[model samples]
Target: MKKFWKWTNLTESNPTERILTLNGTIAEESWFDDDITPQLFKSELNSCSGNITVWINSPGGDCVAAAQIYNMLMDYKGNVTVKIDGIAASAASVIAMAGNNVMMSPVSMLMIHNPATVAMGDHNEMQKAIEMLEEVKESIINAYEIKTGMSRAKLARLMEEETWMNAKKAVELGFADSIIEPDKKINEDEKEKNKASDSILFSRRAVSVALQNKLKSHYLANAGANTGTDITDLEKRLNLLKP
Candidate 1:
């Protein structure tokens, strides 16, 4: 069966690193009838011997799944690095917290909110659901508080508001550790020689992608922009920058 969550160790260089790409909805799409459970994630974690970089782009899912993933990541022997390539929200945000270092593209987004549930019963059942949800919300806050060191009250309020933050805002609020730098060109021969098979090279490449993104944003925001450069000069500069 096809796997929704991809886990692989990039073991072709000096210091191998694991690459886990988590796209789609967390626990929403299952490859097997009952996969992506804690045991499954634990098994995958056991396979890797070094640091793992998780690339997350998800709208979140199954709080329990997120909690399990978060715990496994925290328990891993090697450092956990998270990169938000697109969006991390709801349960997915919880997984992001497992990161010893979290990075996001300038355009990426992070979202947090109170947990919810559906219960069918009398008033007692309704009340039970509320209590359960409250407990879950607290658990979610634990992750956020540890990462941001924000007071529980403020964090709760943000969650209550379902606050969504851009990469810069995420960093300012302490959800993300850093923003990717703008994209920069790398030499073909040097790139081949430094092919990203190790943590150091992989990291360098991540930064390069960040820088490249920033460069694109800069060019778009400055297109026909009248900062100080004139039109003809701007055109010339843009032409010169063209690859």
Candidate 2:
């Protein structure tokens, strides 16, 4: 069976910071499958110590598996940092809520919606399925509420609407702490250079506007002297003032 998670130790000597990559579907096998059971994952997790950085890029699968993973992370002793580099939808979003510090890439997306299942039976069976789904939805809202501090009713409304959020929106909605940026360090010189560039751009636009206003005033003041000039000629003169 294909495993959804891969582990990498960042430092050989310290082994304090580990990276856990969860890609693709959360679980392709059944929840009880021996090869990909959450017990096996927990064993691997318990083998290590210190901080963990989880990188997730999944479309979501198997809500039960996701719930188990979320619980495992929450129970871990080490600090957990979750970085979503791609889409985290449906069940995957629940797992993300376990992070002590959740972050998303600028282009990453997060989606949440009501749980769904198929049922083939009479009206009684259909009602049973509906009740089950309602309970499952409430359980999901519990996770969202812990992370966002939003009211259960509001969260339920968002889930019912199938809310989608970009990195900025996720931070705004309290679903994520912040958006991830490049790790490279910028020196003071580079910072000043960027500031200078912005100032120069602003100054150029200001100069262009000032020149256009002056030309307009000049043309209007000399209107009597230049009766042959039409509005078209004045527009052409103003166009030349653009940088």
lDDT of each: 0.79, 0.84
**Top of the candidates by lDDT:** 2
Question: Where in model 2 is the C-alpha error above 4 Å?
Answer: 12-14, 32-36, 183-243
Clashing pairs in 2: none
Candidate 2 global lDDT = 0.84
- Candidate 2 per-residue lDDT over residues 1-243, each given as its tens digit: 678999896768657899999999988877744544788899988888989999999998888889889999999999999999998999999999999999998679898888988898999999999999999999999999999999999889778767777777788778999878758887988756543123211133445568767877887888888767675676788678653
Error of 2 at 158 (Å): 0.8
lDDT of 1 at 13: 68
Stretches > 4 Å off in candidate 1: 11-15, 29-36, 185-243
Residue pairs clashing in model 1 are: 181-210, 181-211, 182-211, 182-212, 183-211, 183-212
| Model 1 lDDT tens row, 1-243 | 334488877757625799999997877645234654556778878975888889999999888878878888998999889999999999999999999999987678888878987699899999999999999999999999999999999888888767787777788778989877558766788556533231111122334447666766676777776456555555566557543
